[model samples]
Target: MKIYNTLSGRKEEFAPADGKTVKMYVCGVTPYAPAHVGHAMSYTFFDAVRRYLEFLGYSVVHVQNFTDIDDKIIERAARAEVDPAKLAERYIAEFYDEMDSLNIRRASLYPRATEELPTIVDMIQGLIDKGYAYPANGDVYFRVRKKDGYGSLARRTLEGMLAGARIEPSSHKEHPMDFALWKGAKKGEPEWPSPWGPGRPGWHIECSAMCHHHLGETIDIHGGGQDLIFPHHENEIAQSESYTGAKPFVRFWMHNGLVQLGEEKMSKSLGILVTVKDALQKFSPDALRLFFLSSYYRSPLKFSEESVEAAERGAQRLRSAASIEGQGTGPDLDSDPYRRRFVEAMDDDFNTPQAIAALFDLARQVNRAFDEGRRFDEAQSTLRELAEVLGLTLRGLESGTQADIAPFVDLLVEMRGELRKAKQFELADSIRARLQALGVTVEDTAQGGRWRKG
Candidate 1:
């Protein structure tokens, strides 16, 4: 399989270092608030990538880190008059709900910054011991110039970066480009005992330390949103490479594009956001996954209710076709072509849009089978297998409005079945039509009278 490496600026063949397991690290959230749809989009994409890699026979050990202790979390906690750890835990639980709703696979390890203080402290000390970092007034900063080719990931020279970058005033740092490794804790803020006074790990260092401790000195792939390509990931590279004396801390760098509301990116800091909870309540999981996978991972995706509704309709088409049962009297159905097309598209930089198109094409073929009075069991199973790889759970062709009414629908379906057995064709047909009007579809296949909410 080929993947787009953000570091090399092109698509390259994927080869794990040990030729067996692929170690992947994707940056997680700060847990200051509930996760938004943008977070859903990124995590969903990575989940599919991981699934596809495993589908190709490589064991994937994925690690996603949580920034439980951050300036945002602390500041928000203070505003609400709550302990920062309590606030972080609340939001972290809320994030899990969102991820579970979106069907995101749990990472192999979810190391939190608050839980990795010792490792974070050791990493900072190692940087200082190597002369690549220095301590100043109970704070520590990494010397940016000490790392050669610092801006290679972002593809900008030091002078260019200085012109465009926002230089925050820091009295301890010798240069504006130098970033913090540890910040001295204040009286109210959470702190850990460290060599450089009481302090907490910086945002960038927490990830480096967590990934190194969990995955090893170097990993196969490191992924995050495109917005992190700059100072955040660049700083991670600076510290991780310098601390380990490894030339390339990560072999493959993967980044997904931002999800947009209008012209601006959907971010909590921007104050314009759509929470994942809102989306999950309004749309099905298949619909949300379809909405994001409709576009390439590296391209910015626009958010709209209309778009999600359209995706829902599209997903309904696939589900409806998948629900068809073959009569055993039609022509033979083959799914090999569809499977081949899906793999071909996915192998090229994990092209989900094209892969979904292959699914649609199979759905169309399955529908054609029903029209030709042919059996489509093979096609239906194939559709399920391919969609499973994308982490999309195809809902029952008939999705009911409420879970509490399943028994009631089953009673109605059973009554209709008896009516048909008594040779009451017209009355039974009327019953079927009434059920269909109520969003329940009853199909009397050779197997039995199967019914589901549509």
Candidate 2:
């Protein structure tokens, strides 16, 4: 298998540092607020990557960290009149619900920043003791010039970096390019008692400490959004390697493309952000997963209401086809050939769009099998397996949202249909009104009425 390594700026063959096991870490959210579509896009892509590796028989140990204590979280908590820890925990649970709804597998280790303060302090002390870091006032900053490969990741010259950094003229710093490793806690903010006075770990230092604590000195793959390519990831590489004496902190650096609203990037400041909760009310969790997986992990995907509606329609067709049960004596289920196409497409750098096309072809095969009145058990099994490998729900459980709506919708539709046929127009209108009030949208189509949650 080969993956595009951002560190090397090329697609290189994937060889694990350890035999038969792939150790990976992807930067996770800060949990200041509910997860947005951008966070979902990045995590879902990494989940697919991890799932594919596991499907290929590689024991994958995936680690993603939660930055529980950050400036944003502190600010949000203060505004809400709550403790920062309580606010972080609330959003963390909400994030888990979103991930579970989309069928994302839980990571092997999810180390939170608050839980790993000792590790963070120890790593910073190691860097400072080794002369790669310096304490300024009460805060600790990484000495950027001390690392020979400081600009290797970002590929900027020292003179250019010094000039380019939007640095304030601070009292304590050897250079303007140096970034904080430990931020000294100010009053009215969340903090912990650390060796560097009362403070919290800087954003970049948290990941380095977490990876070292969980995945070890080096990992096979380190992934995050494309925005982290600059100061965040570059600082991680510098601090991690400087402390551990490891040549390469991570062999592969996979950065997912950013999420955009049409031509503009979706961001909190831009006010074009879509939260997962608001999105789930309109599109099924599976539809969101399908929409994200429809693009290559490294390519930017533009998201819009129209695009999501299209994906929802397409995904519904797959689910409808998978629900078909073959009659006795239909097409030969064992003779279908679309599985090979799906596997081959996924093999070529996890080209999910091509893989999705293959799935559609297989769904057509099911249609053909039903039209011919042949057994389609083989096609059904193949579809389920393919969907599972993609971390999609082929056959939803008979619980949760599906279960609650399935029998109720059928009963309500049947009653409404009976009333309409009986010419009791007033009663039929009343039933429709009640259903609509309950958040069920009933639309009359050519064949009959269709119902979905509003």
Candidate 3:
């Protein structure tokens, strides 16, 4: 299979370095708040990659790390008046719920930064001993110049990066581009005892340390959002390769483009994002997955109601095609060509848009064959199998029977009524709006709020 390597800046044939299991490490979320659709988009792409790799008969050991302790986590925890650990735990649980609801496969291991502190400190000390890092005040900074080809991943020299970068000068840092390995403890923040004073791991180093401790010194794939190309991923290459003495820390670097909202990229820091929980209330798991896959993984996808609504309709079409029980006793519909088309599209750097087009074409033929009194059972099965490779569970409209979701909808309607009685009109209205957006109409009678699926 051909996959795009961001480091190489081109598509390359994919094969496991060990010629067996694929060790994939994806950068997980910093669980300061609930995950947004942008998070869904990133993970969904990686999940599809993993699913496809496994479908090709290669076992994939995927490890995704949680930035459980970071500046954002500490700050959000402080504002919420809770311990950082507790705050991260809350959001981590929420993350699992939303991801599971979206039908994303769980990673093999989810190592948290706080839990991997010992490995982090050990790696930091190794870098310092190798003259690749130095202790500054109570912090340790990676020497950007010590590593040859420092900016190879990002394809820029240290000098070129500094020209356009706005780096804050620090007295302890030897160079402005030097990134921290271990940060010094502040007055109010989580701290861990390290060779350098009590402090937590820096943003970039946590990922390196996690990869080393979980996946090993070198991994097959290191994937994350494109925004992390510089500084974050570049520094990972330098420190990881420096400490492990491995030429390449990651064999393939896969990055997905950001999800955009109006004009700006959907970001937690910018507070311009729609939460996955809120989105799930308004769209099915199949619809969300189809919407994300409609665009190429490397292309920035604009999140819009119209696009998602259209995807929902497309998903319904696939569902109808797949559920068709053919009664014809004639010859079976030829599905090998559609399967070949899917494999070809996927082989060309996981061209999912083309693969999906193949599925729709196959679905169209299945519908036509069903009408023509020809056997279509195998074609329906083929459609379902290929869709599963993309993590699309064509399990009816909303992933379950109305009876299965009725209790949850009823519970939400009841909660909305309670919110209205408590004078939380805004929250109540929001629930109503979200339910309406999901095609459920709520009627407010003198008795209470009643809901019916449209």
Candidate 4:
């Protein structure tokens, strides 16, 4: 299979470091607040990477980390009058709820920064002992000058980085380019006892330590948002290789494109953000997932209500087609066109757009079979396998909601219709409010109102 390697800036054939076993690590969240659509776009991209590898019959071991102790966590905790650790825990639970609603597969190991303090401190001390890092006033900083080929990932020189001031000046560092390995404990912040003094791991060091601890010194894939390609991933390569003496810290580096809001990055600081919980209230979770898959993983995804609505319409078409060919018997093991098309698309750098197009192709065949009054067992099975590869569900292409909410929504819809026909606008609005309160949404259309589960 061909996968894009961010370090090389080219698509390369993928081969597991160990035979038939793939180990991957992607950066997780700091958990200060509710996750937004941008966060959804980030994790959803990596989840596709893991799912596709497993679909190829490789034993995949995926690990993601929780940055439980950070400045954001501490600051937010102080404002909320709760412990920083408790704040992290609450948001971590919310993260899982968001991921589960979107059908993300859980990672093999979900390591938290607090739980891996020993590993982090040991790694930091190794850097210090080897002369690659130094202690300055209870803080440890990596000596960027000591590591040769330091800017290979960012393709930058120390001179250029300094000129650009990407490497900001630090009074205590041996050089301005050097980054912190361990941060000194501050008032009202979490800390661990370390050789350098009681302190916390730097942002970059936490990821390197966590990745090495979970996936080893060398692993098949290391991935995160494209923003990490610079100081974050570059510094990771330097410290990890210097400590382990490994040639390459990660064999293949995969970076998903940035999530964009017009010309700007989506940010809570700017107030132009939508929370996952709120967005899911207006649209199906599958719609957002499909919107992400519609673009190549390595391309910028622009967010706007109109664009999201467009994605929703396209996803509805695909889901509608699959529902038409509900449950059926298995297909013949051979001569499965859907299987061939999907594998071919995935093999070519995980081109999901092509794979989705193939689904429509199969939808045509299923439609023809339905018109002929023929059993579509083969077509049905093909749709199931292919959709699984794409991490999508047809949800009974030809069926209705089977959950307990189905009956409740059906009753509410009838009541809403009667109230509307009576021209009791106030009563109809009240019924709609009641349905929404029950986590059921009612939508009015030319054909009248219909309700769906929240």
Candidate 5:
């Protein structure tokens, strides 16, 4: 398979270093707050990548890290008058829930920054011992000039980066372009006992250390959002290779484009984000996945309700086609061509848009065959299998048996009854109409309101 490599700035043939298991590491959240759709977009794409790799008969060992001890977590914890660790744990649990709702597969291991302090300290000391880093004023900074290919991943020279970069002026830093490996302890913040006094690992070093501690000195694939390319991932490359004496820290660098809201990217710092919970409340998990995968992984996607609603409709179409059970025994549909098209599209740097189009085309053929009284059970199975490769569970929002949805239907009916009692006839009628649209019919009797699946 050919996958895009940001390191090489082109698509290249993909193979594990060991020629067996694929060692993958995608950056995880900070756990300062609940995750947003931007997070969903990144993780969902990675999830699909993992699924497709498995489908291609490769075992993938994925390790994602949690930056639990971050400035944002500490600051937010102080505001809430709670311990930072407790706060981080709370949100980490919430993150799991949100990802689960989105049908994202769990990573093989999730290493937290707080739990990996020893490895961080050791790596920092190793960098300093090798003269690639220096300690100044109780903080450690990576010597940018010491690394020969400092900005190779970013495709820029040190001079070019320094020219346009926003260098934070510091007395302890030898150069303005130097980034912190460890920060000095400050009042009212968490600190770890490191070689450079009592301080915490910098934002970039935690990930570097985590990857080394968990995955190894080098991994097959390293992925994150494109926003992290400049200083975050670039520094990761410099320090990791410097510490481990490995030439390439990561074989493939995969970065998904940011999700935009209005003119600005949806970011935690900007407070411009739609939480995954809120989006799932309005749209199905399948719809959200489709919306993300409908766009190329390397291209930025604009957030819109209309787009996701349209994806929901598309998801329903696929679900309906897959659910059809053929009665006549004539000719089995030839699904091999569609499968080949899907595999071909995905093989070309994971072209999910074309792959999704193939699925839709196959769905149309499946429906046509069903209408022609031909046995379509095998074709339907193929549809479901291919959809699973993309992590698309061919199930609607209100999937499962009648018992599972009865509670929600009953609640809606009760709400409609209250609306009718309040003389809000319009809203009550709308709710009834919605229920009918979902194949659930409601009846009003002297006893109360009743609901049944049609």
Candidate 6:
């Protein structure tokens, strides 16, 4: 397999340090509010990475972290009159709900900042003791220039970063690029005992510490949205390598592109939002998952009602083809070619849009074979198997409320067929019209009447 490595700025042959296991860590959310589609796109991209790796016979130990404490979390918690920790807990649960609705596989571990306090404090002190970080007024800041190759991952020199002034000047810091390792505690906020009095870990340090504590000093893969590349991930590289004395903190830095809303990025600060909960209500798990896969993982995905509708229509084609009634008759269709195409597409830096195109190719052949009174179970199963690698489910009803109503629709279609056999035209037509109104297509087949939900 070959994947683009942000660290090297090129697509490189992919393998783990051990050549057997993949230690993958993707940045998780702060959980300050409901997760939006942009968040869905981010996590879903990484989830596909994990799933695709495991499909190739490699053991993948995936760890995603939660920023249980943050300025945003504290501010939002204060506004809601709830404890910051409690607020984090609430949205953390909601994150699971959104991911589950999207059929995202749970990571091996979801370590929270609150739970990894000791690990955070120990790493900060290690940096301080090594002269890479210092304690100032109960706050600890990393000496960015003290660490060689600090901006290598992002491919910027210390002088260039300073010129850009990506980090605002702080009077206590020795340089403009220096970032916090541990923040000083304030009133009415969470804190822990550290070498520098009592304080919490900085936004970037929490991820570095969580990775070391969970994955190890050096990991196979580190992934997040593209927006985190500059300061957030660059800072992670500086502190982690400095603390562990490792040459490369992460083997491959895979950053997925952002999901956009028109001209602007889909972000809370932009005041443009579409919650995953609300999206799940309007679309199926396959539809949403397919919508994301329709675009390359590293390309910006645009959101539109028409685009989502088109994905649902494409999902329906797969569903409709699989639902065609038939019995095994003629020769079994060869599916190996389709499988090879899918694997090849994904193997080339996880080109998911190309892989999805291959899936639809298989789906078309399945439907064509059934039309000839010849069934190919192998072909249908191949389509399902390839879809599984992309974390998409083809056989189920649309997730959420529609999933609950599927059986009833099937039953009513069956009853309506019975009424058609009994020559009850009026009642049969009434049932058919109602099903059509609900976007369910009831087709009369020679085998019997079959139905599909749009």
lDDT of 5 by residue, 181-253 (tens): 9999898789988767898989999889989988898999999999989889999999999999997899999
Candidate 4 C-alpha error for residue 45, in Å: 1.6
* Residue 321 local lDDT, model 3: 85
Model 2, position 252: C-alpha lDDT score:
91
TM-score sort, best first? 6, 1, 5, 3, 2, 4
Alpha-carbon runs more than 4 Å astray in model 2 = 334-336, 395-454
lDDT of each: 0.90, 0.84, 0.91, 0.82, 0.91, 0.88
Backbone clashes (count) for model 2: 5
Candidate 1 or 2, higher lDDT?
Answer: 1
**What are the per-residue Cα lDDT tens digits for candidate 1 across 337-403?**
9999999999999999999999999999888888788878888899988999999888763344546
Write candidate 4's Cα lDDT for 195-300 as tens digits: 7788898888888888888889998999888888898999999999999999789999988887788887777657677888988777676778888888888888
Candidate 1's displacement at residue 248, Å, is: 1.2
Of 3 and 4, the candidate ahead on TM-score is 3
For candidate 4, the TM-score is 0.86
Best by TM-score: 6
Candidate 6 lDDT for residue 252: 93
Question: Number of backbone collisions per candidate, in order?
Answer: 3, 5, 0, 4, 0, 0
lDDT of model 3 at residue 326? 36
Residue pairs whose backbone atoms clash in candidate 2:
329-374, 330-373, 330-374, 330-375, 331-374
In terms of lDDT, the poorest run of 10 residues in model 2 is 394-403
Using all chains and alpha carbons, the TM-scores for the candidates as numbered come to 0.93, 0.88, 0.89, 0.86, 0.90, 0.95
Candidate 1 — what's its lDDT? Answer: 0.90
Q: List the residue pairs that clash in candidate 4.
A: 323-396, 323-397, 323-398, 324-397
Clashing pairs in 6: none
